[model samples]
Target chain A: MGEGMIQDQSDEDLMKAVAKANQSAFRTLVNRHMGRANTIAMRSLPRREDAEEAVQDSFCKIWVNAASFDPDKAKFMTWFVRILTNTCLDKIRSNPPRAGDIDALADVLADDAASYDAQYGQKREGEAIRKAVQTLPDRQRMAVILCYFEEMTNPQAAEVLGINVKALEGLLVRARRDLKGRLGAGEDNDG
Target chain B: MTDDDLKKRLRAWTVPAPDSGLADRIVMNALRHPQKMPWSLRLGKTLETWLLDWNAGAIYKCASLAMIVVIGLSIGYSSPYAGGADTISIVDLAMGGMNEWEGS
Candidate 1:
């Protein structure tokens, strides 16, 4: 099919084509989702390079498992995000964060850490808040990342994490509380 | 922090959009590795290999002949109904001195 035709195809249709080992369809898919995949990876892992590695690893996996995916079970975006999340997590575990990893996460957590599309620079207050967020437990950090940073709906984030909505909610509540405590009383909820 | 502040800061986070060339790179990498076919495709390929891709009409004839031989052997030698429903077995017939060895 023509490029326009491929671009117009639904994610599921492209996925079906991918299952047939269609290289063009796979290219279209990678172009479409790579941005958000990168964003999620940046938030999930400690370094930009690590995030890149994770995204690359994930695309390779998607290629391998394309035929096994069932559209009825989940949306393509959700499934892809789940794979990216798992890949990033594995990369994070395999290479333990350096001693200054918290500093690295804090640096990347800034408002302008990657804001390529716009002039998004992190303010001092926001930096403190993000550092607080980075200090959360892995699951709690993931909860915050998906629900807040990635702007995923609670149910959707829960689905991606392979947890029930209630469990995800509990993690968010705890993460928020932890962030608030770290940020302190009056400034905790500051804008 | 306030939910709005948190969301705003997150929106500002400088996460890189993957390089435009990365997609092409991934496609090339995948091509080099030629992924395994799904089971359904493999099954279809198997049918084509064993049945459709050969000297077409002869495959079915040979398959049919093989089936006939297997069925005939089962009935004549290993079949429980060899003597009859009420009869015991080929072994029983031999032990009772009711039959001689085949080709004797």
Candidate 2:
């Protein structure tokens, strides 16, 4: 392809080509988004294996539905994240985690804080923050995870949760207030 | 601290890295069974390409013409003119009676 033609091929164009069974175009799109999708899935789903499956499912869904994707409704990344998050959430809800699993996660969080602080030399504050986040209400915790850990924008996070942008903002606000209160910060702490 | 600051700190806390090879497995699976194109889309593209083919276009035109000719022949066979002369004789008798009645 000529440089001009290549320049004109946006992600949407590539997706359209993939819909026509263009292998190279499909590969390019998969390679570009796979890491991000995997990250989001892993964060949302309780099990690593389930997360991987969800990511794969999301990619397949994207491929089948590529032609129907409306650029007017959302950016490609946002749309992709929405699919990934929803897939993970569906899997998680279908198979609730075992009691031991929740405990295992709490242990993992503690270990993570220790190791990260050891490597970076920021101990007390990291531990405090982790504890505060862990104490957040389940919905607030999910919102914080999707918004912060998964790096999703507010609108995209809202889409994943099936809520409007304003609702998402309220959730975030309440989450922040709760976290600050749990951390022994007064209401005026603003976090 | 600001909420953003707290968020930054929370992000620093260790979330387990997903199991290794997940990405590779996903990509391989995707490559093995790429999404099946919608049936409608596949059918439409096939029709479009078939219509664009010269031989297909010629065949289509010939079939259309054949259809038109068959319809024309059927219409001709069923036409009023194709009815026997007895029907015309009946009409003429009815017309003659009407004329006589009008004259009287």
> Which pairs clash (backbone N, Cα, C closer than 3 Å) in model 1?
A111-A122, A112-A122, A113-B14, A114-B14, A114-B15, A115-B14
Q: How far is candidate 2 from the true structure (C-alpha RMSD, Å)?
A: 6.4
True contacts kept of 2: 0.32
Output the worst ten-in-a-row residue range by lDDT, candidate 2 chain A: A119-128
Interface RMSD against the true structure, candidate 2: 3.6
**Best candidate (score: DockQ):** 1
**lDDT of the candidates, in the order given:** 0.76, 0.69
How does model 1 score by TM-score?
Answer: 0.74
Positional deviation of residue A67's Cα in model 2 after best superposition, in angstroms? 2.9
**Model 1 CA deviation exceeding 4 Å by range:** A104-130, A185-191, B1-5, B38-41, B44-51, B54-67, B70-104
Worst 10 residues of 1 chain A by lDDT: A117-126
Give per-residue CA lDDT, model 2, range A22-57, as digits (tens): 666766677667777766665555566777788888
